[model samples]
Target: MLADTKKVGGFLLLAAALLLNGCKEEKAEVGAAAPALAAYDLQGNPASLEKWQGKHVYLNFWASNCGGCLVEMPVLEKLSKEFGDSIVVVGINTDKEEMNIQALLDERQVSFPNVRDQLAITQERYQVIGTPTAFLIDPQGKLTGQYIGMLHEPELKAIFEKSRQKG
Candidate 1:
């Protein structure tokens, strides 16, 4: 009888542990504001987010090694051309090597803002769990929307239009 009681008690404890774990919430870091991105342009000029204010910004987190990012680069390039002045599409490199990123960009002919994640601070602050994560920030500097994985040109255009309206 004691052994059966102990078994039941252990089962209850396991269920309680599972329930507590399920209740855990993602905690945003204190004073966590918009990620500060200071990556360089193709010409080695400093590209900062401050320069992108008063316009819709599409910040894309990707790496040269990511297969999905390779496929999305062209679509992003097309979108950048279409919404040239209305929106800014900035690509953040998640790879550790700068040369690899530069090579990919050169091969793809990507002319948008290309920055490298030197410290991975932005990734951690944004809680980015996957490659090809895109954050849509309004002109007012508020996070308006987030997209994960490869994005289509039309979808990006739609988001840019929406941000313009809000601006």
Candidate 2:
């Protein structure tokens, strides 16, 4: 009985160690090339991150239910307009309900290219653990920076400038 108990304890320790290793955060390098992404636009058209190459891309992970996302969308829209064709801003909504996300976009007058991550696959791929996470990708398709909250205009502009410099 004592031998069996020891074996079980050892197994538990091994399992715990494996779990902790799995939970380690992946460190993504800034200026690293962006990974290929296949996701859908708000209109349900198939879109690829590669399509936005040769332009600075701002990718935002959002949800209709998130308050911060609500505030950030308009800011993103303004930036999108200011940047014009020089940059592309994409809002990837993680909301499972299509209607809710669409309604919010319409009400907010979100002008940027918006997408829906129905299965949250993009979230998992980008390692996005929270709403309002933004990734700035340079014209050469390299990741320049990541912002993880309500972004003020100045900070976003700084990231945009950094991406521009990468080109």
In candidate 2, position 117 carries an lDDT of 77
Candidate 1: where is the Cα deviation over 4 Å?
1-33, 38-47
Candidate 1, residues 1-167, lDDT tens digits: the string is: 99999999999999987865443322223223355554565566766678988888888999876888888888888888877777888898877744567777888999888887655656765667889898887666667677888766677678877866766
Candidate 2 regions exceeding 4 Å error are 1-29, 165-167
TM-score of 2: 0.76
Q: Which ten residues in a row have the lowest lDDT in candidate 1?
A: 23-32
Q: What is the C-alpha lDDT of each candidate?
A: 0.74, 0.77
- Per-prediction CA RMSD (Å): 10.3, 6.4
* Count of backbone collisions in candidate 2: 0
Using TM-score as the measure, which candidate wins?
Answer: 2
lDDT of candidate 1 at residue 134, scale 0 to 100: 83
* Number of clashing pairs per prediction, in order: 0, 0
